[model samples]
Target chain A: MMSRKVRKYFSFTAFVLPAFLFYFSLSLLPTMQGLFYSFTNWHFMNPKYGFVGLQNFINIFTKDRYFVMALKNTFKLVAALVILQPLIALLLALMIEACAKWLQKIFRTVIFVPYMISTIVGTFMWSFVFRQVFTQIGSSIPLLGFLNQSWLSNVDLAFWSIIIVSLWHGTPLLMVIFLAGLAGVPVQLKEAAVIDGAKPSQVFWHIKLPLIFYSLTICMFLTIKDAFKSYEIVYALTGGGPGWATQVMTLNIFEEAFSGNYMFGYASAKAVVFLLIVLVFTVAQLLLMKRREVEL
Target chain B: MTRRITPLYVLNILLLTLLALIFLFPILIGFLNSFKSFQEIFLSTLSLPKSWSLDNYITVFQRIKLLRSTGNTAIVSALAIAGIVLFGAMAGYKLSRTRTKYSTVIFLLFISSMLVPFHAIMIPLYQMASKLQLKGHLPGLSVLYIGLGVSLSIFMFHGFTKSISREMEEAASIDGSSEFGTFFRIILPLLRPAMGTIIVQMFIWTWNDYLLPVLMLLDMRQFTIVLSVNTLFGEYGNQWNLILPALIMAVIPVIIIYIFFQRYIMQGVLEGAIKG
Candidate 1:
């Protein structure tokens, strides 16, 4: 009886081991390996590597201007996305909720179409829209002639262009998420508020906002994480070009390792820093939001 | 449910229509210019295609090997999703059912890795893949995805398995069913809702992934749809005649999937956002 109980407990391993094998070799082991590699000078071409300790991290902080620039650009994008993406998505969700049922479906479907398409595909299409279609529209409508500026080539404008494209590609899914949250707001609560002579906007602020606060936290978390990990839209749209004006951390780390730099060890260090920044921001956001959630 | 359509409601509809049009403008433009000749595209992208010709589509189809790449993508996505759902469900179910120190540690191991960005691990993963000779192969890439994907799938299933009652499994066991037999017969069927969410999410992520494929696939023939289209874009810079058509073709599959699985996809996204 004792042996049978022991054998029964061991049987659970059969269910868990297959998935664990793949995950350990590919995900968990590589993570530790990456941290280990960060402390060494592991060049892509060179087989031999030596421990470099804190040199790579120090250099990234003090020496590499490009890394610094990428850091700044990443923060800029994240800030914009965290603030603006949810705001737009929330407004869209609120408006869609106001529409008739059938119209709501059409609006939701149309807005989300861009999201279903890959970021690269959508970014490439927008590149055409910015270059050719903008010029055509600018020339045809004299009042809108300013739209003909070199959107991708210009440094300042290129950043905005990436933001515009990212928002276009990203906002719809958040909108759908917000729509779900809004749907969960109990109808009776709103009706009760309205019976008390609360206007629609007032009811929204008092009743709906508190109810959907959880979704707000989720959107904020998703936006911050996504903005930090953003690669495809910027990579395809500008290839981190216009003189690396739009480079983010992922693109920087990728180019360092692959695009002729071959600084695998140094890139690994950048990857570590990238991971830390994301972890800090997202974990902090979650903690903060969880506290706020309890308050409400 | 009937209510008066007030002025505020009219304003809402008008605003939603305008935003939706803005959302669809680039896609609509890409579709229109895909049918136009090169010079026509340059002349006025907003204008209708003069002839609605299929010449550019034919060229793009042949140039990018769209059919072949699409097949490759489909194969990769299918294999990866199958592995993820099976392995994820089994492990998630077992982990949720068990209560031991090792189980807690194992579950934490899977959950904690969800926060690590892929770029942080890409270099080491690539090196590991090369060492194992898993690089540059479709099945190997699917295996990598299974590894990368199983964490989230496990998390989802684990959360979902809690809501499933243990009575069925207990009953099956008392009826002389073996453990594996009970799991397959009792727990697996009860896991369908979680499976639907997992399958939809996994399919979209694997199908639309670009960076992983770009890193893993070496040969043009093995290239997925996005890779083929990207290759065309690189080789023919500013040649909208070729690029636009491929762009249009690349998005058609996802759009179709969205149309069919809109409810499931939206629910999956909502669940992922909230729980993940």
Candidate 2:
């Protein structure tokens, strides 16, 4: 029986081996090699790499202006995503649920559609809309001229532009998540709360929010992680330009490794730090949220 | 069930319709502009063209070689999705059923990887690709995408497979099915909905992917639709005619897929969002 069990285990391993091959080759092998390369100044275009212990990290911390700014910007973006996106999504989900049945799917479909488009393409389309259409619309309204600024060109407004785009693409799905969580909130519980003289807001704050915390936490994790690595949209829209004002970390790393010069090792160190930051947040979220999944 | 459509419900429907328009209007703008001549596209930025013309499409087809790029994208995306579904389900099922330290760690690793930004490793991955002589090869690019996408699909599949019954697999085994046979017979068939969900999502992601394809496929012949269309931005002068037509070509697949499989896509997204 024991030998048979071992044979069964081998069979199962065979079943998983194909995915493992792809995963290990592309994801693990490259990343592990990247960590190795970080210890050496392995320039991609050149062969003159030699071991340099903590120099790359030391240089990044000491000399890189963009690195420090990237960290601060990333954390700021993360804070905004963690706090605002899910809360707004939850509120929208509530409003949509109180809506008519026929209209709900339409709203859900519309909201999620942007999420499906190329983030780069979508941001570009929004650029045309932002630079031209929104300006045209904003200027027409009296005293709201503050909104009419050159959004993509402005250092101040560009980050907010990226944030708004992120929210627009992201919020719909979170809204849907909240809607699904709403489905799990027992009707009997809602009715009981109503009978016990709970107002709608009170019931929602006390009941629906607690039940939906799992979805909220997942949304928060995704939002923050995505915010950490926000590159493609910012890359496409600003090209990290109008004076590096909207330049995020990933873009900084990309330019460092590619266009500026081939500092592959330094880029890898930056990447490893990024990986660590993402790992810390992910682990923290899983620990915080997994306990609250409430297996039911 | 017997209630009439109230004023509030009417207002909600109107609001949703307006919002859906906002979602749809960009693609619609691209589509409309594609039909218009270059001059008209500029003159009337947002309006119906008087008549449809295929000149822009023909020009782009001749120039960018749309059919071949579409073919390459289709082949790569199909293979990648097939790999993800077949391999992701197997791995997900195994991890979900077993509770060993190693398997649990692997599962966590997969989950946490979703958090890690791809740009971090992109430079070195590109180097490795060059070294292995895998750059510009369709199969090589497909493999890279499969690796990148597996984490999310497997995370999803793992959650979905846990809801499958032990009794069903046991029944298959009792009837002379081996463990492999039982998994294939009982478990795989039961996972069609999830398989559909993951495949469509993978299709969208892999189809719209820009950065990897841009870096890898250095030749014009191997350009995916996105790579082809995005080159518009770099062209000396923005030929709205060529660019708009190319954008249409890139998006049509997704729109077609959306129309047919919106229900499945919505369900899949909702499952991903709420469950995991």
Docking class of 2: medium
Q: Residues A1-296, candidate 2: write the lDDT tens digits.
A: 66987886797688667777777777777788778877888887678889999998998899988888877777877787778898878867876777756667767776777777777667656655566546654676667677678888988788888887777777777777788888788888888998999997999888887887777777777787777878777777777767877777888787878886878888889888888888888779878887876544
lDDT of 2 at B92: 90
lDDT of 2 by residue, B1-276 (tens): 233678866776676667667666656776777788767755665668878878878888778787888899998898888888888998898888887887888888776666557876787788777877779878878878888888777888898888888898877777888887877778999988788778867877788888889889988888887777677656813456666677777667777777788888878776655555
Please provide TM-scores, in order, for all candidate models, with all chains considered together: 0.98, 0.90
lDDT of 1 by residue, A1-296 (tens): 55976876778888999999989999999999989999999999899999999999999999999999999999999999999999999999999988878988999989988878888888999999888898888889999998888889999889999999989988998998889988888888888888899998899888888888888999999899899999999999888879989999999999999999999999999999999999999999999987766233
How does model 1 score on DockQ?
0.86
Q: Estimate, for each residue in B33-119, the C-alpha lDDT of model 1 and write its tens digit.
A: 999988898888988899988999999999889999999999999999999999999999999989889899999999899998899
Candidate 1: list runs displaced more than 4 Å. A294-296
lDDT, candidate 1, residue B137? 83
**For candidate 1, what is the TM-score?**
0.98
Clashing pairs in 1: none
